[model samples]
Target chain A: MAQNKVLLKDIANSLGVSTTLVSIVLNGKAKQYRIGEEIAQKVIDAAMTMNYSPNLIARNLRGGKTQLIGLIVTDISNPFYSAIARIVENRANELGYTVVFSSSDEELKNTKKLIEILLSKGVDGLIIVPCDGSEEIIRELHENNTPTVLIDRNFPNSDISFSCLNNYRATELATQHLIEEGFENIALIGYKTRMNHILDRIKGYEDSMKKAGFEKYIHVKKVNILNPQAEVHSALDTLIKKKNADAVIFLTNMLTVAGLYSLNEMNIKIPNDIAVVGFNRNDLFNLFYSPITFIKQPLEIIATQAVNTLIEKIKNSELEIKSMVFSEPQLIIGASSKKV
Target chain B: MAQNKVLLKDIANSLGVSTTLVSIVLNGKAKQYRIGEEIAQKVIDAAMTMNYSPNLIARNLRGGKTQLIGLIVTDISNPFYSAIARIVENRANELGYTVVFSSSDEELKNTKKLIEILLSKGVDGLIIVPCDGSEEIIRELHENNTPTVLIDRNFPNSDISFSCLNNYRATELATQHLIEEGFENIALIGYKTRMNHILDRIKGYEDSMKKAGFEKYIHVKKVNILNPQAEVHSALDTLIKKKNADAVIFLTNMLTVAGLYSLNEMNIKIPNDIAVVGFNRNDLFNLFYSPITFIKQPLEIIATQAVNTLIEKIKNSELEIKSMVFSEPQLIIGASSKKV
Candidate 1:
C-alpha cells in the first residue's frame, strides 16, 4: 500500500541481476552465487528500507517447498520440553525456516493424527518429541525418508535419526547428589513409562545406588503421575509406608515439582525431612519457595545441535548417520538437597 | 494394515449412500442433509469400532475449509496465559477444528509478523492475544474480511470482534477481597505498557479504593517484569519505601509470580508484613509455597464463546456487529491474603 516499496523485481532491475539473485541477497545466501559482498549488501539494505517482503505464496508455489519446519512436542506445559521447543524454533528460524508448533497431550491417537497433519502442512523437516512408542509411525516416517531430528526424550529403536540428552548421566548425577546428602534409602517415584528417557533415568539411579553398595535398598515404583500432586502423594505414602525412603528422586520435572508441593502440604520439610532431585531443569526451580536441586538439561545446546543435524540431513539428502547428540548436563545443588 | 479398517467408502457402500452422506453423518450434520438417524448411528458405531478416520486433506479441499484455527498467545511459560491458550485450543478442537499455536513473547514486532505468517498459512480463522493497539494492522485484517476473534485482551478503537473477561470488575473484586481482609494500604504493581487489561485493572482498583474510602492510601507503579530479577527486587524496594502498603494487587500472573518470589527473597511474610492478590489463575497459585488468592478467568466459557463467534463470522461471511462478549470472572480464595 505504500509507494516506493521495493519489489523483488525492482532489486533485480537495479542490480542488473535476476529475481533469484535478489532473493538470495535478501536471504543472506548470495555468497553461494559468488555475488560481491558490496552488491549484496546494497540490495539487502534497499529491500529493508522499502519494507519489502517476498510473497510467500508465489515463492512457495514456484519452489514447491514451504521451507517450514514442524515441531511436534508431546506436552507443551512441561517446561523442559517447552525449553527445547523454543530452542529448536530459534535455531531453525536462524537457518531460514519458519516453524509450526503442535503438542500431542500424551494421547496415542493424537500423536498419529498430528504426524499426518504436520506432513500435509508441508514442513521441510520435523523435530519430534514422539508421543508414546508408536513404532509403526516412526517406521512410516522413516520409510518416507523425511528429514527429522528427535530430541529431549524419544522412542527406543525408533531407527529414525535423533539427538537426545544423556538421561542416564543426568540421573546418575542426581542419585550421587542424594547419596552425598546422606540419604541411603532413596525412592524412585515415577511412572513406568515405555519411553526410553524414563527407563534410562531408572537405570542410572539403580547403577549409582549399586555402586555405592546399597543395591538391596534400591526401590522403584511404576505409578501414574497424570495428576502430579495426587499421584505423588499416593506414591510417597506407599514409599514411606513400605521402604521408609529418606529422600526422593523424580524421573521427570512434573513429578519433582508435584512431589515437592505434596511434601510441603504434608509438612515434610525439604532436605531436613526428605531430600529431592529431578532430571529436568526450569526457571522456577531455583526460585521456588525453597530452592530445588535438579540436573538441568542443556536445552539450547541440544536444540542447536538438533537443528544443525537436521539441516545437514536436508542438505546432504543421502547422509545416513543415526547420530545421538548429547549436550553436557549440569547439576544444580540447592538447599532442597544440601547436606546437613 | 488392519483388515477390518473401515473407510468412508465402506460406510457409504454399507448404507447405500454417497461418501458425503457418511461424512455428514460423522460430523453430526446429517439432519441438515435429510439423512436418517438410524443410518447415522450405524455408520458412527462401525467407524468407531474399526478406528476409521477421514482423510482430512481431501475433505478440506472439498469442503472449501481447512477446519483449523490459529491461536497466537504472548507467552506459554506463564501458566495463566497458557491456561487461556489451552482453553481456546480445546474449544476449537471440540468444534472439529485443530489449533495451530504460536507465541510472540510480548514483542510488538513479532505480533504483526505472526499475523502475516498465520494469514499466509491459510488458517480458516484466528483468535489473537494482541500485544499492542495495532488497530491499523487489525484494520488491514478486517478490511480483508478475515475470520478473526480477539480474546482475553484487544486493541484500542480497532473495531476487532473479541471477547474479554471483565478486567475492571475482576480487579475490583480482588481489591475488595484485600480490604475485607483488613489491608488498608494497597499497591498495584505490573507492567507499565498501555495494555487494555492493565488499564482496566488500574481503573477497577481506583474504583474499589474510592468506594471503600481508601483512595488516599492507594499506591501504584508500572514495572517491566521481563527485566532482570534484580530490577524486580529494586521495584519492590521502591514500592515498600514509597507506599508502605500492606499488600500489592498484581494485575497479571507474571507480575504475581515474580512479586511472590521477590517478596519471599526479601523475607517478607504473607498477610503479615504484606498481603497479595493476583489475576489469571494457575495451578501453582493455590498450591504455591504460599497460597495466593487469584481472579480466575472462565477459560472454557471464553474459549467456547470465541470459537462460536469466529465460526459465526466464517459461516455468515459478513459479520454485522463488533461482538465484545464478556464472561464473568471468579475469585479463588487462598491462604495468602487471609487474616492471620
Candidate 2:
C-alpha cells in the first residue's frame, strides 16, 4: 500500500528545501519568513503535487482555533430541528467553519456528554438546543468563556445567549385563529416540561382561552423522549374522551404527528369533529387530505442569527453579548382549522 | 472570568507538583511514570478540585488519533439521512467516538472539500453517503488507507466498502405491489443521478415492468439539490400529461413530498386517479389521510453496520475489507397502493 500521507518533510525532501521552508510557503507565510520567491513557488508546487494538507489537529493545537463548530439538537430526524441544522451548517460553511453535529435525544446526560466531547475535540464554538438539567453545564461553559449559544431552548438561570421562536406569540396567534374559527372547548396537547419554550406555548394557549372567555382544558402529556408514540396516543385519548375537546392545539412537532395519528385511528374528521393547529410546519401538513393549520417558525433567521452570534463571540471574546433573539412565527391556515 | 479555564499547570501550582506529574496522575499513568501512590492521589485530588481537563487537541497531536469520525451525507435536513446520522452518532458515541457531520448537498465540489476538511482535522475514520464525481477522492482515501465506508450510495470504479439498502429488491417489490394492484402505465419519478443506488432502483422498476409485460416508462427528473420542489412539480406534470402514467413510484424520500404535492395540486386522488409508492419510510407516510405505501429500510441496522465497519477499520487498518452490505427493505402497504 502507498504511504498513508505525504507530509511537509516529504515535499521538502522532494524539493531539496527545509521542512520549515515548505511549511512556511504552503501556509502562505514565506514572505514573513524571508524565503526566496522561486523556492517558495517550488515548495508550493511540490506540496500540491504531493497532496500535503496541513494536519488540522496540530494546527489547532498551536493556534487554539479549530474553525469547527459543534451543534447539538434535541432531535435531528425531526423536520423542524433538521431545517435549523441545515441552515446553520450552510451559514457556518459560508463563514469558513465546519460543523460537528450530534443529537441529544432529549436526554440531559447525553447533552452533557456531547458538550464535553465537543470541547474535547476543540471546537471553536458551540450551538446547542439544550435539554433539561443542562443549566449547570451551560453555566460552566459560560464561565470558561467558551463561545456558546443556545438555540430553541434556554435555561432561566444561565443567561446564555439564545435564538428562539416567539413561542408565546406563535401559540397565541394559533389559538386565536382556532377561536376565530369558532372552536370552543379547545384543548392544548403538549409534553409536560419545565422548558421555557414549552411553558410559554402553554401560557399562550391559556391567555388566549381566558381572553376568549372559555375554560382552559389543558391535557399536558408526559412523553418519553425515547418512545413518545405511546404517550401521544393515550394523551389524545384522554383529551377527546375525558375532556371532550372540540379543538386541539399541538404544542410541538412530535405531538402533532401523534395527535394526527390518534385522530385518524379514532376516525375523527378534522375540523368537523375537532379542529386542529400544529406548532411547526411539516410537509405532511401540506400534503395531508385536510391540510393541517400550523405555525411556521422562521427557522432560517433563527439559524443564521445563532451562527452569526456564535461566530462573532468566537472571533472577539470581548464583544458585547447580544440580547436573546426571538423571531416571529407565521400561522398557515389550512382546512383543519376551518370553522365548524 | 474565573481564570477562563483550569489547566494542569494550575492544578500543579496549587498542589506544589509538576504539571507532568499532574498529567500523569490524571491520565492514570502514575504507576508507569513511577510516581508515589500518595503523591499520585494528591495530584488527582488537586486536579479534581481545580477542575483540570486535558487539552484534547494537544493530546491528539501527541497520540495521533482524535477519536472523531466525520459523517458526510447528501442532506442532513432530510429525515431519511437524519435518521441514519442519528444512529451513526449513537453507535459511534457508544464506542467512544464523536461524529462530525456535513451535508454535501449533492455537489461534487462540496463533497470533495468536506472529505479534505475531515482529513485535515485528523478524524480517525469517515462515513460518507457518496455523491457523484467522488470516486477519485474515495480512491485516494482507499490508497491512503484512510478508513472510510460509503453509505447509501457507491461508485462503480472504487472498491470502497459501503452499507446500503437493497435498492433493487426494494424497488422491485414496490413496483410488483403496484403491478399486482392492476396498475398499468406505471411511471418512476426520480432524480436523475449516476449513483449506483439510484441506478439500481431504476433498473428494479424496469425489470418489474418487463416481467409484467408492461412497456417501461420512466421520468427521471433533474432535481435541484438546493430547491427541488419546483422541479418535482414540473416532472410530475410531464409524467401525467406526456407519459399518461397511471401509477408513480417515487425513488427517494424528498421526491415523494414533491410528487404528493404535485398530485394534490393537480387534484389527483390517491389509488383512485393515480396510485403511488414511495421509497424510504417517512412519518408523514403514516400520518397522511391516505397513508402512503413506502419501502422502509432498516435504518438502525444500516447505521450500526456502517459504524461498526468503520470503527473496525479504524482500529485495525490491516483488517480484511468487508464486502458491501445490503440490508433488505420492507414494503409497507397502505391506502395509496390499493387497487382501484
Candidate 3:
C-alpha cells in the first residue's frame, strides 16, 4: 500500500513552498489564510501529479473520526432490506460519510460478531436492522454509548433510537380492509418469532378480528423463518382446508412471497377462493394474475430518518437524546384483496 | 470514539503480567511462545473485562493489508446486483475478508469516484461491475497494478481478470428457442450502450435471426438504462405495433420486468399473441399468468469467482495472472414462451 507514497513535504519541496502552506491550501483554508490563488493552484497540480492521497486510516487513528458508518441487515439479498440499504447509503453519502455493510443472517451470534468487526474497523456509528434475540448485545452497545440506530425492528420498552414501520397499525389496516370486503374467518400468516415487530402485527390482526366480532374465527399461523416455504404451504393448506379461512394476511414481504407460492401451488383462486393482503410490495405483484394488495412501508422515509438520526447521534453523543420515529404504512388495494 | 480506550499495557498493569506476554497471549500465540496456560488465561480474562478491541485501521496502515474488499455495482437495490452482492459478501467472509459496497449508478463519473473513494480507504482489493464508458478508469487501475476483478461486465480486448456470463450464447439460446417455437419475427430488447455484455446479446440475436433466414424480420429495440421503464414501454409498443414482432427476448432482468408491465397494460397475451423470454429469473415471475421463460445467469458462481479471483490478485499482485471466467447460463423454460 505504501509503494509510491507521496507526502506534503514532497509536494512543497518540489514547488519551493512550505508544507504548512500546501496543507492549508489543500484543506480548503487558503482563502482564510490569505494564500494566493496561483500558489494554491500550483500546489494542487503538483499534488495530483504526485498522486498524493490523504491516509484516512492514520488520520482516523490520530483524530478519532473515520467518517465511516456500519450498516447491518438481516440479508442483503432481501428486497425490503436492500431497498433500505440503498437509501441509507445515499443519505449517508450526502452527509459526508461512507457506509460498510454486513448481513447478520438473522442470527444473534452473527449480529454480535458483525458489531465487533464494525467496532474494530472503527466505524463512527452504526445503523442496524437487528435480528431476533439480539437485545442484550444492543443493550450493551447502548450502555457503552455507541452511536447506533435500530431500523425495521427494535426491542420493546427500550430507549434506543430507531426508525421503523408502525407495524401495529399496518396490520390493522390490512386486516380491516379484508374484513370490510366481506371476508370472514380471516387468517394472518407471520413468522413464529418473539420479535416485537412480528408480535405487534399479530396483535394488530387479533385486535381487528376481535373488534369485528369474529374473535372465534381469529386464526394466526406462525411459520419458522428457516423453513418458511414448507411451513407456509402447510399453514395455508390447513387454513383453507380444515380451518375454512376465506381471507389471509401476510405480516412481511418474505411471508407474502411464500404464501403466494403456496396458494399458487394449491390451485387456489385469489379473492374467489381466499382473499389476500401482503405487508410489502414487489414488482412481480404487478404481473400477478391478481395484482397483490399490500401495506407499502415508507422505506425511503424510514431509511433516511435512520441515517439522519444516527448522524445526529454520532455528532452529539454527549447529549442524552433518544428518538423513536415510526412512519405510517399505506395500504395499497389491488385485485387480490378486493371483493369477488 | 476513545472515551474508554483499553490498551494491552493497561491490561498488563492490572493483571501484573508483562505487556509483551499480554500481547502474545491476546494475539493467540501463547502456545507458540511457550506461555503458561494460567498466565494466558489471566491475560485473556483481563482483556475481555477491559473490553479490548483491536484497532484494525491502525494495524492496516502499518501492515498494508486491510482485509477488506470493495464491491462496486450499478445499483445495490437492483435484484441482479443485490443478489450478486450477497453472494460476494458471503464468499468474501468465508475468505476472512469483509466487503464494503457502493453503487456506481451506471455513470462513469460515479464509477471513477467510487473507485477513488475505495482506494483512498485502502481496501485490499476491488470487485466491480463496470459501467459503460468506464473502460478508461478500469484500464488506469490495471496499469497501476491495482487488485481488481470486473464482474458481470468487462472491456473488450483487455487483459483484466473478470467473471461474467456468456452473454452471447445466452441470448442466442433464447432467440433460437423462439425460432424453434415457430416464431418468425423475433425481437430483442436491450440497453443502448457500448457495454460488451449488451452488445454481445444484440449480436447473438442478430446472428441467430440471420442464420434462421429471418434477417429482414430481426427487430432490435434498444432502451436507455437511465429511463428504462418508459423506454421499455415504448420499445414494446413499437415491437408489437410497427415491427410486428411475434416473439421478444429481454437482455436483462430489469428490462424483462418493465416489458411485462407494458405487455400487461397493452392487453397482449403471451404465446397466443406474442411469445416472451427473459434473461433472469425473479420470484414474481412465478405468479404471472404465464410464468416467464428466462436465461438464469449463475449469480453465485460469478460472484464467488470474482471474490476468489480478486483475493488471488491481492495475494499475488506481482504475478501476471489474468483469468477470465465465463459461466454458462441456463435457459429455464416456462409457460411464457411455448408453442400455441
Candidate 4:
C-alpha cells in the first residue's frame, strides 16, 4: 500500500528531471517559470501515468482555492432537484470545479449543519436551495463573504444572488389558462410555507382568480412540505368533494405527483371530471393516463446561472454584482389541461 | 468579512478560557485531557454560538480523518441512482460522515477523473457505481487498500466488496412469470455492455426462455448505455414489428422507461398488444397509462449495506472483512404484465 503511493519525486526520477521542475509544471506554473511546453507536457504525461496527485490538504492549508464547491438541495431523491444537480455538476466540471452535494430534507437544522460542514471542508463556494426560515443563516454567509448563490428560491430584501423561476408568473399563467377554458371553480394545491417563492405562487393564483372575476370560486389546499403525501390526498379530497372544483393547479412537481396519485385513487377522470395543470414536468408525467400540462422551469439556464454566479463571486469577491436572474416560466399544453 | 471569521481564540476570549482549552474541547478530546466537564461545555457552547468551524484542511494535513466520503454514480438525474444516493447520504450522516457525490455519466474516463479528484480531496472512502469495463480501476483501488465498495453492479473474479441485487434471479423470475402467463415470444431489452450484471440479466432471460421450450422465440435488443432512447425506439420497433414478440422484459429502470416511451409513441397498447415488465420501480411508474409491473430491488437495504460496509472498511482497514452481499429482488405484479 505504501509503495503504491506515487509522489512528485517518483515522477521526477522516472522523467529524468529535477523534482522542483516537475512540481512547478504539475502545479500549473510552467509558463510562469518559463518552462518549455514540450518539457511540461512530458512531466504531465509521466505524472498521469504514475498516478501522482497533489496533496489537496496541503495546498488548501497553504491558503489556495480547493476548486471544490458544495451544493445544498432540499432532497436529492426528488427528480426536480436531481435534474438540477446533474446540470449544476456538468457546468461546475466545465469550470474545473468539483461539487459536493447534501440534502437538507427541508429542515433548517439540517441546512445549518450542512453549511457548517461544507464550510469546514474549505469549499471555495456554495450553491444552496435554502429551506424555510434560513434567512439568518444566509445573512451570516453573506456577512462572512462566503461565495453563495441561491437556487430555485430566493429571500426578499436580501443582497444575496440567486437563479430562480418567476414562480408568480408561472401560476398566474396556469390559473388564467384554466379560467379561459370556462372552468369557474379552480383550486390550487401548494405547500403550506412562509417561503417567498411558494407564497408568490399562491398569491399569483389568488390574484389571477380575482382578476377573472372568480374570487368567490377560488379555493386552495396547502399541504405540509415534508410529509405531504397523506396531506395531499386529504387536500385533494376536500377540494374535489367539498368544493366541487372542476379544475386544479398543482404548485410543485412533488405536489403534482401526489395529487395525481390521489386523483387516480379516487378514480377521477382528467379533463372530463377535473382538469389539471402541474407546476413542473417529470418524465413520469408522460406516462400518466392523461399526459399533464405543466409550467416548465428552464432548469439548464437556472443551474448554469447558479454555478456561473457563484464562481464569479468566488473569483471577484469585491465585484459587488448581487444579481437575481429569474427566467420566464413556460407553460406546456397537454391533455390534462385541455379545453373543458 | 474579516470580523466574522470566528476562531478558537475568539471563542476562548469570549468564554474567559485559554485557546488551548477551547481547541481541546472542540477536538473531542476534553475527557482524554482530563478537562472539567463544566469548562468543556462552556468552551463548546461558545464555539457553537460564535460559529467557530475548525479548518478541515489543516486537520487533514495533520493526518486526521476528514469525515468525508465520496459517492460516484452513473447519473444523479436517474431516479434509481438518486434514490440510492439519498439513502446512502442519510445513513452516512447518521454515522457522523458527510457524503460528496458525482456522476460518471456511464463513461470510464469520467469515472477515473472523479475517482482521482475524490482521492485528492482526502475522502475517507468511496462508494462507486462503476461504469462498464472498469475492472482494472477497481482492482487498483483494492490493491491500494482504499476503503471502497461497489454498489448496484459488481465485477466477477475480483475480491471487492459490493451491495447489489441478484440480477440473475431477478430476470429469471420475470421471464418465468411471463412464460407462465402463456406468452410465447418474449423479448428482453437491455444495454449493450460487457458488464457482468447486465450479462447476467440477459443470460437469465435466455436460460429461462430455453427452459420453457421457447428458444427460437427468445429475442434480445441491446441499446447503447449513454444514448439509449432513440436506439430503444428502433429496437422496440424491430422486436414488435419484425420479430412479433408478444411480451418484453426490460433489464433496468432506464431501459424500461425508454421502452415505455417508445411503446407510447408507437401507439401500442399494454398487455393486449404487448405485455411488459420493468426492472425497478419509480414513483413515475404509478402514473403509467397501464400501471407497470416491475422488479423492485431493496434499494434501502442495498444503500444502507453499502454505507455500513464502506464505513466499517474505513474504520477497520486491517480487519480483512471482504464480503459481497446480494439482496433478493422481488417482482411487483401490475396490469402491464398480466395473464395473456
Candidate 5:
C-alpha cells in the first residue's frame, strides 16, 4: 500500500478494495453502497497507520481554494465576540478548514489592514463583523471573487454577502419587555454613535417607544467605558434627577457593565430602584448577584450559518444575493427586569 | 516606487532622500527621533503617490523575525484572559510586532498544535497561558531555540521564563482581610483541583489561617465551573447545615461569578451576611452593584514584558535562563469585604 503519499489507488490495493471504494472510503462521500462499519474502520485505520498524507494543499489549489476561512470580529476581548469566534473555529475545524481570527477593534483602518492581511495569507472565505466606513472594502472583496459573510451587523447599499440578526427587532423586543415590566420612562444607554449595530439598536428602541406611544419619556445617554464608572454615574444621575427614566435598556455589553457599576455606586437597587436589560448576553450576566435580563444572540447558530453559507459560496461562485439575514435572538427574562 | 514590490531604496531615490529617512517615514518608526514632522510627512506622502509596496513577509524575515507573536490563551470568553490578550496584542504592536492568537481551551493537544502551527508560521516568540500538562511541548520549544514566556500559570522544573501574580500571598492577604473584617470562620470556594494556581492559592489560604491560629474552623470547597452555582450552593448549604462557616472567599473570577449567583439564589448578602473576595477582575464584578474586591493583574505591563522578553531570547539565541518571575498583583478592597 502506498502509505507515504496518500493516493486514491493505494486504498484500492489495500483490503482488495477498488480505487473508487478507496476514494469513497477516504472522503466518506458514499453511503449508498452501505459499506459495513468494520470495513470502513479498517480502511481508516490502515490509511492512518500507513501514514498516507493527502495532498490537501494541492487539492485546494486545484479547487481554487486554500480551505482556510478568515473571521473578523470587532473587539476580540469582548466575551460575546470571543464566544462567536470559538463556535466558528470549532465548526470550521470539523469541516477541515483552518480559521484565522482578526480583530478590527472598532476602527476602519484596522479593519482594512486585517482584510489585506487575511488576503495575503490566502484565505478562501471571510466572516466579518464589519466596521463603519468599510462598505467599499466589502464591495471590493466581492468584486475580487472572495466568498464573504458578514455576521452580527448590517451594512446597506454595498451589495456584499452577509448573515446578520434583526438588530432593530431585537432592540424593540428588549424595549417592549421593559415596557411590559412597568418601566414607563425608559432611558437608553450606549457608546457614542458610529457602529451600525449600536445605531440599529438605538433606532429599534426609539421606534418601539414611538409605537408604544411613550415618546416624551425617551431619554438617551453616552458613557465612555475607559474611565470606568464616571460617565455611567453622571448619566444615571442625570436620568434620575431629571425624572427621565424609570427604567433603562443598555444597547451594548459595555453600557450594561458600566451602567450597573454606576447604579451600584449610587446604591441603587435593580428592579427595586430601576429596571435593566441588554442586547448581548454576558456569561456572567446570569451569574451577577442581581442577574440582569439579556437577549441571547443565537451565537452558535449564527456562527454555524455564517460558516455554512460562506463555504457554499466558496464551492459555487455563482450563488445569488451578496447577502442574507438570519433570525433574531430571544429575549431572556432574568431578575433585573422582574420588577420589584 | 513600486507598490507590489516596493523597496526603501527605490522610494528614497524617487524622493531624493536618504534610505534611513525613507525607512523611518514609511515604517512610522521615527516618532521619537524628532525627524522633522514635515519632512517625515512629505516622505510618506511621496511613497503614497508612487504606490511603494512594503514586502511585510520579507522585511519580517530579514529582521530576524516574522513581526508576529503567538498568544495562546485558555479561554477568550473569560474577561480576565481576554483582557490580557488585548493588552499583549497592543503592546506587541507598539513593539513592532503583530499577534496571531490561538486558544487552547484547556486542552493539551490543541496547545501543542497551536505552538507547532505558530512556529511553522515563523513567529518570533510566544506568550502562553499554558494548560496543566504542556511541559514536554514547551521543552521542545526550548530545545529548538524558540523564546517563550508562561503567563497566568506556572510550569514546574523548567528553564522557561514566566509571569504570574504571587497568588498565595494575594489569597493569604485576602483571607486575613476576611478575618480582619470580623468573620472568623471563612470558607474558600475555588475551581476544580489539579491546577498549579488552585494549589498555590489553597496553600496560601491554609497557611495564613494556620498562622492566625484558626485552623479548626476553616472550610475549603472545590467546584466544577460548568455548573458552578448549583454545586457551590449545595456546598454552602451543606457547610451551613453542618455549622461550618460564616464567610466565603472565591479564589478566581470564574468562581466569583458563579459563587455570587449561588449566594444570591440562597438570599445571602455580601459582608453584612457573608463577607467575600475573589482573584482577578470581571466587568460584572464591579457592576454587581456591590464592591467586589479583586487582585488586578498588570496585564499591559505583563504582556509587554512577556513579548519583549520572548523577542530578546529569540534574537539572542545564546541567552540563558533558569527561570524569570514577575511581581505579585495588588489586592484591592471593596464593599464585599467591608468590616462586618
Candidate 6:
C-alpha cells in the first residue's frame, strides 16, 4: 500500500514527461515554466486521478517557506497563554498558515532548544513568550532576519517587536480596587523573575500600595516551573499566617490556582478572611466558590496584532520593526474581592 | 549579519578541505566514511571556530526524519485536551521527540487539512483525537504506514491503535453515582454526534437509567464549535423547562461550562434546584461555589501510553498494533451531586 502511493515520478512516467515538468504543472507553475496549456491540463488531470498530493517537506525545501508558524509559550496549560494560542491559531489558519506550539516551561535552556528545533523545522515565522536568559538568542534571531515577534513578555534591551498586556496598569487597577474595597495591609504574591511581565506586575502593586500610604507586604516566590505547587503553598503560608495580609493579589494565573488551593486547604473564607485579586481571567475564576476578581487581558487584540505583525515581517524582511504594542486590561469585580 | 552566518562551505574554504569531508566530520560520520583522524579533527575544529550550525532543512532532506510528532485534538483551549497535550509533549520530549500540536475544532475538513500539513512537514508519527468524518482518512493513513495512534476518542471500525477512556464505563459509573445519591428524573446532556465515544456515553446513560427503572431524559445538543456558548445556553433552557429534569449530567468539559453558566444565569441552587455531574475534572470543579461532581480520566496514563505506543510503532513498523487500551475513570463526589 505504501509503494502504491503516487509520486511525481509516477505522473511523469505515465505521461511520458520529465518529473520536473510534472512537478511544475502540478504546482501551478505551468505558465511561468512555458508549458503548453494542453500539456499542463493533461498533467493536472493525471495527477488528480492519481491522488497526487505534493510533499510539503520537499516543497518547503525548494521554496524555503513552510507556511508553518512556531509559537513558544511559558505554559500551554495556563488559561492566559492557551487563550492567546487559540486566537493565534485561528488567525494564522485564516492566513493559510498552520501553527506548531511548544511550551518552554519558563526555562531559558528549554526556550533556546525549542527555538533551534523550530528553526530546524523551517517555520516561516515565530511568536514567542520569551523566558529570562533568552535575550541573546532572540537578538540573534532578529539579526538573522528570522521574522520573530515576542508576546506576553519581552527583553527591555532587545529591539524585537512584541504584543503584551499593560501589566503595570492591570496590577495597579487590581490593587486600587482592593484599596477601594477598604482592605488594608494588602499583600502581593507573584513569581520571582526578571521577565518584563512579572517585574511590571510587581511595580504596579508597589506603586498602588505607595499611593494608598499602606505598608507594602510583598511575597515574591521563586517559580520552580517543574514544581510550582510547593512554591505557591509556601508563599500562601507566609502571606496568610506571618504577614496577616487582609487582601492578596496574585500575579499570574498559575499563582492564583496555588493561592486558591492553599486557601481551600486552610478553610479560609473569601472576602471576609482575605480579599483576592488575580491577574488573568479564566473560567475557573468565574466558577470558584466565591468567584475571584481578575484582570482580563485583551487576548484577541494581542493575538491578532502579533500574528499580523509577524506576517508583515515575513512578507517584507526589510520592513522596519515596530515597537511593542500594549493592550489594556479590564478589572472584573467578583465576590472574592468584594468588601464584606 | 544574516549573510555572514557561517556554513559548512565557509568552514571548508577556510580550512582548505573538501565540503563533503567537512560535512562528514561535522555530522560525526568521519569514522563511517573512513576519513583520516587528523583531517576529521581539523574539520571539526574549523567548524566549531566558525560557529557553524547545520541547517536542519538540508539535514532533514538528506535524513528524511524530523523527529517531530503531530498531535491533533478537538480543541486546545479546552482544559481536558490542553492537559493531554501538555502531558503528551512532556512524554514525547522524554523520548527525544518534539510535539507539534493542532486543534481540529471538531471539523472534518480542518482535521483532514491538518493531517495533510503534518504529513507534508514529514512528522514521524501522529497522535489524534479524530473528528466524526475522519474514518476514511485515518484508514488511508494506516495503509500508508504513517505511525498513528488515536487518543481520547476513536473510530471503532478502523484498525488504528487508540488510547481512550472507557466511555461506557465512565458514563455508567457517573450515572450510578447520581442514582446512589437518590436523584430521580436525571437528564443527560451531551453533544449530538454519532462518534463512538459519544454513542458509548449515551448508551451508558441509557443502560443506567433503564436498570434504575427511571425514564431516560437525554438531551443531545447540537455542538456549535464556532459558537458553543449560545448552543449550551439554549440546551440548558430546554432541558430544565421542557424536560423538567431534577438532575443533569454534562457529557463534556465545555458543555459543563455552559451548563454551569446557564445555572448561574437562572440563579438555580446546585443540588437543591438541579443536581449536576460533569464528565471531566478541572480546577473549576474543585473551586465552584458548590463544587460539582465529575469523572476524572487518567490523563497521564492515557498520554504516556499513546506516546509510547506510537514511538514503538515508529521504531519497529513490524510490531503488531495493539488493541485499544481503555483506562478507568474515577467519579469524584462533590456538593453539586449531593442528595436532597
| Better TM-score candidate (3, 6) | 3
Q: Write the per-residue lDDT of candidate 3 for residues A1-340, one digit (tens) a residue.
A: 4346688889999999998999899899999999999999999999898989876777777777788899999999998889998999899989978889999989999999999888877889899998889998998888888898999997889989999999999989998998888987899899988999999989999999999999999989999977599999999999999999999999889999989898998999997999999878899777788999999999999999999999998898889679899899999999999887
List, residue by residue over B300-334, the lDDT tens digit for candidate 1: 78877888898888778754657887788898888
The value of fnat for model 3 is: 0.68
Segments of candidate 4 deviating more than 4 angstroms? A1-53, B1-53
Cα lDDT tens digits for candidate 4, A1-340: 2325677889888988898999899989999999999999999999888778777777778865778899999999999999999999999989988888899999999999999888777889999999999989988998888899999999988999999999889999999888887888999988889998998999999999999999998888888999799999988888888999999999999999888898899899998899999977888777787889999999999999999999999889778769799889999988988765
What lDDT does candidate 2 reach at residue A40? 86
Ordered from best to worst TM-score, the candidate numbers read 3, 4, 2, 6, 1, 5
Compare the candidates by TM-score and give the number of the best one: 3
The residue-level lDDT of candidate 3 at B336 comes to 89
lDDT, residue B317, candidate 1: 72
| Model 1 per-residue lDDT at A267 | 77
Can you give the lDDT of residue A42 in candidate 3?
Answer: 96
Distance from true location, Cα of A115 in model 2, Å: 1.9
Question: For this target, which candidate reaches the highest DockQ against the unseen true structure?
Answer: 4
Q: Which whole-number lDDT from 0 to 100 does residue A220 have in model 1?
A: 89
In Å, residue B123's CA in model 3 sits off its true spot by 0.8
Once fitted onto the true fold, the runs of candidate 5 whose alpha carbons sit more than 4 angstroms away are: A1-69, A121-125, A220-235, A267-269, A287-290, A313-321, A338-340, B1-48, B57-65, B116-124, B225-230, B321-323
Ranking of models by DockQ:
4, 3, 2, 6, 5, 1
TM-score-wise, the better of 2 and 5 is: 2
User: For model 3, what is the alpha-carbon lDDT of residue B271?
Assistant: 73
Q: Encode model 1's per-residue lDDT on A1-340: one tens digit a residue.
A: 1113357998778768788878887877877878888888888877877678775545654554566677777666566666666677667767866666677787778878877766655566778877565656766776667777787766665567677778889889988888877889987876757888788888989999999987987988766635556878878877776787888888887887777667777777777777788657654565566678888877778888888887777666666747677666788888878766
Model 2 regions lying over 4 Å from their true place: A1-53, A215-226, A319-322, B1-53, B215-228
Q: What is the alpha-carbon lDDT for the whole of candidate 5?
A: 0.75
Error of 5 at B84 (Å): 1.4
> Is candidate 2 or 5 superior in DockQ?
2
Report the poorest 10 consecutive residues by lDDT, candidate 6 chain B. Answer: B218-227
Q: Is candidate 1 or candidate 4 better by lDDT?
A: 4
